[model samples]
Target: MTGKSLADYQKEYERIIFFDQPRKDILLEGLQTEMEKQFKLPMRSKEWKKENQKIIAMYRKIVITRTL
Candidate 1:
């Protein structure tokens, strides 16, 4: 996996938050796909556990911040 930088995520988060409801849903799906592609691990695998946690945490943070 080519580790993505914090800035890359921050930028995507910003873009997602700026989108309207329908677009946001689409973007989130795309983001999830991108994450899966980047991680290159099946969702159920033990190896994916830690990264998945981090990704979910970061996604929540972005959504929370957007609401603020």
Candidate 2:
């Protein structure tokens, strides 16, 4: 309502959708549904070693997007 334009709000909307993490509950729900449709991924690999760097990266994106 200040000096902001529609373009400013549009960019903010995109940032919130893309950068901000969703609630954990929503994330879990989406993961469950999407998992069924997903084929084997570089994420859920059978050859994962103890390091698990790839798995951790995927987890960070899904559940650890923001600190609580």
Name the TM-score of candidate 1.
0.58
- Measured with C-alpha atoms, the lDDT of residue 5 in candidate 1 is 59
Cα shift from native, residue 36, model 1 (Å): 0.6
Q: What's the lDDT of the predicted structure labeled candidate 1? A: 0.63
Best by TM-score: 1
- Clashes in model 1: which pairs? none
lDDT of 2 by residue, 1-68 (tens): 34433344334334444543445445444553343234223445546523555433444454443344
TM-score of each: 0.58, 0.27
What are the lDDT figures for the candidates, one per model?
Answer: 0.63, 0.42
RMSD of each: 4.8, 12.1
Instruction: Give stretches of model 1 more than 4 Å off.
Output: 1-3, 51-53, 59-68
Worst 10 residues of 2 by lDDT: 32-41
